[model samples]
Target: MPAPATPEAPAGWDFSDVVGSDSSLRRFLHGLPGVDQVGAEARAAQLGTRSIKTTAKAFALDLAIRMVDLTTLEGQDTPGKVRALAAKAMRPDPSDPTCPPAAAVCVYPDMVADVKQVLGDSGVKVASVATAFPSGRAALDVKLADTRDAVAAGADEIDMVIDRGAFLSGRYLQVFEEIVAVREACTAADGREAHLKVIFETGELQTLDNVRRASWLAMMAGGHFIKTSTGKVQPAATLPVTLVMLEAVRDFREATGQMVGVKPAGGIRSSKDAIKYLVMVNEVAGADWLDPDWFRFGASTLLNDLLMQRTKMTTGRYSGPDYFTLD
Candidate 1:
């Protein structure tokens, strides 16, 4: 049995356990076999009615190029780091024209001001990872406050990590509650809802089924976006894992008519990989979500490849990724 919808997890609660009193495990298990075929072709056929104007050919490069503006470019990546990101965002280099369509420039909460300044008038949003990021182990108040602070700092979006320890311990309800609360905390900031992307660190979860379940859990808990990995873990993003996630997104849409977003982070080092993801998204989600609004890639080094590919397609010659550093 899972804990009721009160924002509290026992000192040590367990959710995925069949051997526990406080958890959604029994329920989850009972419902497992039903979702097993979520990635099947039959599921895709169901999505035909949900199709929008999205297609890989049209939106692959755009989504691939929408840089998350990782603030880690500089060591003490504080407000100054955000400014530096903005500078890089605004720099006009002949090698990389059009700049990254400026997906939310990710930064620490404290640097929201600098990111805002750097991205001024460009419509690029600012996203901040919070709530003890890469590890959601913290006092609820502390985590909520951190998320609040980020939004107060002008973060247009929030990326938060779940407590893997708790989740792995069979505590699905706790994970669910924490994410919901953080979502609330983010929305409370800026006197409106700031977008929230929940990072599941699927690599740590260790199975495509768990990844799919986690994706569903996040969506059910109100995550506007279900993201993979924190980019801090190895085996960040993989085709099989992402295929599972997109398949979940497709099912959730069929069940609720809600279209949540998908972001694959970590270790995607080349444009070709991005294109492959694009292929998956198109094949899975159909053509309606080809816009940058619903899709994103968390990458620091993938941009040059996207540019190179786009350039090659236009100019009919291969350009090295280093071409971005030149003119």
Candidate 2:
């Protein structure tokens, strides 16, 4: 069970007027209303039925393109691969210049420098996965160093995985404090703090209730964005999971007057799936969360699908997989 909430506010959000004392934090998280799985799923399914066509489809395609964090997180990733992916991000469809570039290219920490070099002046950001990435088992010092290395290497953004072990075991304070420390480490040498994205690996969190709690925890701990997965886990980024997170961000904003972005990574492969997610964002999180700055899709193959659909929209013909370059 989670701890209780205290009356006093924690130091982190004193300025924001959201008192977050340890007991209060626990009370807030644990006291959060439980998720109704059936109702939430029904809502997502119903929203998925919203038909987007013609100009709306065109707009969604472009918006989805701009919202993509075109990712390549393989252990075997090379500089050559990174460059190819960066090129894809800059010009998703070489045949069509109207297609906007993806939001950023996500990679492992060690590849940030190479990605930054390849993507110079393209306006596409470089995001690195740190805080032990894929797994949050490292010591705090090691995690901080990992984050610092990525920021120093020119990562425009940092995606850190929370210590799920600690979180599930009721160590919310440890999880919160770790995020605060990493948020501090996001400060680059140039005095700009790289955007911090907290990934919950929601697949392992087991329930929508936990996803909601984790989302609130991440936002309260100063996550500029809350991500759904690392793309390495099974069941990585599901509709229900992302829906729960969207609601969390929506409520967090209503309660605290702060806006945080949401990223649903992994398993989202087609334009249809992407559009469904957008529908949910529009209806559940409000249209204000529609921009790339407020939302992102951490995806690889989803780009090709968007490109193909865009081609169909333009030429009235579907392009084959051979037409789009592999990244």
How many residue pairs clash in each candidate at the backbone level?
10, 10
The local distance difference test score of each candidate is 0.69, 0.89
Q: List CA RMSD, all candidates.
A: 7.6, 3.7
Worst 10 residues of 2 by lDDT: 1-10
lDDT score, residue 115, model 2? 87
Candidate 2 lDDT by residue in tens digits, 45-112: 88889997699999999999999999999989998899889988998988888889999999998999
Number of backbone clashes in candidate 1? 10
Best by TM-score: 2
lDDT of 1 by residue, 88-144 (tens): 555523555654555667777777778887788787788888988776778889899
Cα error of candidate 1 at position 128, Å? 0.6
lDDT of 2: 0.89
TM-score of 2: 0.94
